[model samples]
Target: MEKIGTIASIKKEATIYKLTNPFRWFAKFGATGGLILFFISIVALVWANSPYQNVYEDFKNINLTFSIGSFVISKGLILWINDALMAIFFFVVGLEIKREFLVGELSDIRKASFPIVAAIGGMLVPALIYYLFNQEGDLRNGWGIPMATDIAFALGFLALLGSRVPTSLKIFLTALAIVDDIGAVIVIGLFYTETIHLIPIVCAGCIFVSMIFGNRLGIRTPWFYLIFGIFLWIAFLKSGIHATVSGVLAAFTIPSKSLVDGHLFVKEGKSLLNEFEVSFSKTKTIKHSQNSLTTKQESIVATMETACEYILPPLYRLEHSILPWVTFVIMPIFALANAGITIEGDLFRSLSHSVSYGVIGGLFLGKPIGVFLFSFIAVKLGISKLPEQTNWTQIIGIGFFAGVGFTMSIFVASLAFLDSNSLLTNSKIGILIGSLLSLTVGMIVLRFQKQK
Candidate 1:
C-alpha cells in the first residue's frame, strides 16, 4: 500500500511539473482575454436591452474627427473601433498569413492541403446556404456574412475542451481560420466595396510602389513603413476601399529579412569583447566609484544593442509586440461595440425572419456538413489527411465550433445591411442564435467523444 501511494504521489508531481511556466502563462492569457470578451458581450447585451439602452446608443454615437483646413474626416466611436482598430487587427492577420506562406504551416503544399480544403468547405457551404434563402433581394448581399469564422472565439472555446482535444487539432483549426480570413478579405474587397475614387486609389498605388521599392533598397527602418502605411490607410479610406484592407497590404511591405549574418555578427561581437576587456583592464587601475559603465563600455553596449536589433526581423517583432494588444484590448472592445443585440419582446420571433434563418441554418447545418463532407472527399482522394490523433468525430465537433461566426460576421453584416435596420437586427439575431447553437453542439459532441 505504501509503495503504490508513493508511486501515485510521484506521478502526480510529475504531471504538475510538466505544465511549464510559459504554457501556463499563455493559457492564462488566452483564457483571460476570452473571458473578458465574453463578459463584455454579456454587459453589452444587458445594457443594450435594459432601460439604460439610450446611454449605450449615445456612447456609440459619440463622434471623433480629424481635419486640415477644408479636408475633414469624422466618424462615430463605434465606427472608429470597427474601421480603424479592426484595421490594426487585420494588419496582424496579414503578418500571420505572410509568415505562414513563407515558413509556417502553409509553406508546404502537402501540409497546407487539409486546412485549405477544409476552409474552402467551411466558406462555400455557408455562403451557398445563405444565398439559397436570400436570393433575388437586397439581402442577397449578406451571403458574405455567413462565410467568415471568428478564430479568436473558436480557438478560445477550443481551449475549454482541455486535454480531450489534441494540440494538432488546434493547429489545424488555426491554419484553416487563417485561410478563411484570406477568403473573407477577398469577398470584402470584391463585393462589399463602395463607389471608387480613382485619384486616392492612384495615390495608394504610388505609396505601395514606394513601399516595395524601399524593401528592395533594404531600407529596414520601421518609421518608413509606418509613415507610408498611414498614407496607404488614408488613401484606401478615401478610395471607397475598406481601410482595414490597407493594413494587410502594409504588412506585406514590412521587412522579414535579418540585416546581419550570424558569422559576421559573431566576429564583430568577439572583436568588441576583446576591446572591452582591454578597456576594462586599463580602467581597473584608475576606477574610483562604481557609478556607471565607462565610455568604451557604453559604446560596446550601444553596438550590442544595434546587433540585437538586426538579429530580430521587424515583421515578426512587430507581430509579437502587437498580438497581445490586439487579442486582449482590441478584441474585447470590438465585442463591447458590436455584440450588443437588444433582446426585446420575443427574440425568437425576429430570428424567424428569412435573413435570420439563413444565417442560423447556414452556420449550424451547413458549416459542419460542408466541412465534414469536403474533408471526407479530400482524404478519400488522397489529397489531404486528418490531423494527427484527431478523428472524424472531433473534426465534426470542431466544424460546428467554426460555425460560431461573431466578429467577422457582424462586420460583414454592417457592410451588407448598411441602410436596413430591420435586416441588420434580424441578421444579428441569427448570429446570436447560430453562434449559441454551434457552441452548444460542439461542446456536447466533444464532451461525449470517447477518450483513448
Candidate 2:
C-alpha cells in the first residue's frame, strides 16, 4: 500500500490549485499593493535627490531601542525595515513553499519538473552573465541580484491583462517564481552570509529542533512555533546568518496534516448537516431578529468553524491572515526605505559602471534567454510538458516576465553591497531599468498575442 501510495503521488495531481482564496488575495490586493509600492518608490527617489534629502537621511538614522531586562535590540529605521519587516515577508514565502511542496503544483515530481528546471536555468544564466561582466573584482558578489523574479510584481502585470492570460500560464509563472525564491533563499543563506557566530547558531538549532519535535508530538498550537521562532530569529540575527532564514526553518515544522482526515471530515460534515436540519425544525426565528440564529443553530455554526480549521490548519490560516499586511504595509515600507537612490550628477555616471552593466545584462538579457531555453529543452527531452493551451509565443512572453526581479533583487543588492554606497546605487539603477524593460516588453507580447 505504501508503494502504491508513492507511485500515485508520483503521478501528476489534478489542477486543484486555483487563483482563489489567499491566492486571489495575492492577485487582487497584491496588484493594488504593487501600485502602492511603485508610488512609494517614486516618492523615495524624489525625496532622496531633493533638497529634503538630509531630512530623509536623518529620519532613517534615528536609533530605536527596546529592552526586556538584560536583553535589548537597538537598530536604525533601515535595519528595522530590512531585518525585521522583511522577515515577516519571508515567513509568508516559507508558508507558501511548504504548501506548494505538500499539495500544490510541486506535489508530483513530473509536474514540478517544468518550473524547477526553468527556475534553475533562470538563476544560473543570470549569475553567469553577471560573473562574465564583473569577474575581475568585488562586484562579482552581486550576481545573485538578478536571479530573483518578484512574484508580486510579475503576477500584478499578468493580472492587468485580465482574461487574456491562460490559467496554465498563471500557474506556471507562480510555480516558477516560488522555485526562484527557494533558490534566492539558498544563495543568501550560503554565499551572502558573512562571519559566523557559532554559539548563537547552535542555540538557534536547538530551538528549531524543538519546534520540529513539537510538530511531531501533535502540538498544533501556533504560539509555540511563533514564540520559539522569534528566539530563533534573534539568534540568527546575531549569528551572522540572515534572520529571515529562521522564518523558513520555522515554517518546515508547521504541521501540514489536518486534525481531521478527508473521509472523516466529509462524514462529519454530513452528520452536521443532519443536525442542522433537525435543529432548524425545533428552533423558531423572529422576523424582527432578521433570521437570528437560535441557540441550537449558533452551537452548530460554532462547531463548523472548528471543522473549517481542521480542514485548513494553522499554517494556512497564518499565511492567509498576514498576506494582506505583507503586501499592503510591509512591502510598501520596504520600498519607501530602500528605493530612494540619489540620482545626482556623479551618480548618473555610476549607472554606467561595472556593477550596473552586470546586473542589467543578467536581468534584461540573461533572464529571458535562460528561462525560454531551459523550458524548451525540458519539453523537447520529455522531462516536462508545456502548460495546457500555452504555445511557444506565450512561453516566450512568460520568459520576459521572469526578468521582472524587483523586490528580491533589491533585497539581495542590500546584502551584496552592504557597505559600498556607490555600488549599491549602481545596482539599484540596473534593477529598476531591467525590471521596467521586462514589464514593458512582456505586457506587449501577452496582451497582443491574440490579435496576432
**lDDT (10s digit) by residue, model 1, range 1-452:** 76688789889988887877666776466456556667888898998998999999998889999999998989999988988999899999999999999889999999899989998999999999999998977889889888888888888878877887788888888898899899988998889897999999999999999999999998888889989998899999999988889999999989898899989889988988898888778777894434467877899989988987897788888999888899889998998888888766797789778899999988898889878889989999999988888899989998998898888888889889988978888998898789889988998998888776
For model 2, where is the 10-residue window of minimal lDDT?
12-21
Q: After superposition, how far is residue 299 of candidate 2 from its true place, in Å?
A: 2.1
Give candidate 1 misplaced runs (Cα > 4 Å). Answer: 1-28, 262-297, 448-452
Which predicted model would earn the best TM-score? Answer: 2
> CA lDDT of each candidate?
0.87, 0.87
Best by lDDT: 1
Question: Which residue pairs come into collision in candidate 2?
Answer: none
Deviation in angstroms for 385 in model 1?
2.4
Model 2: per-residue Cα lDDT over 91-139, one tens digit each: 9999999999989999999889998988889999999999998886678
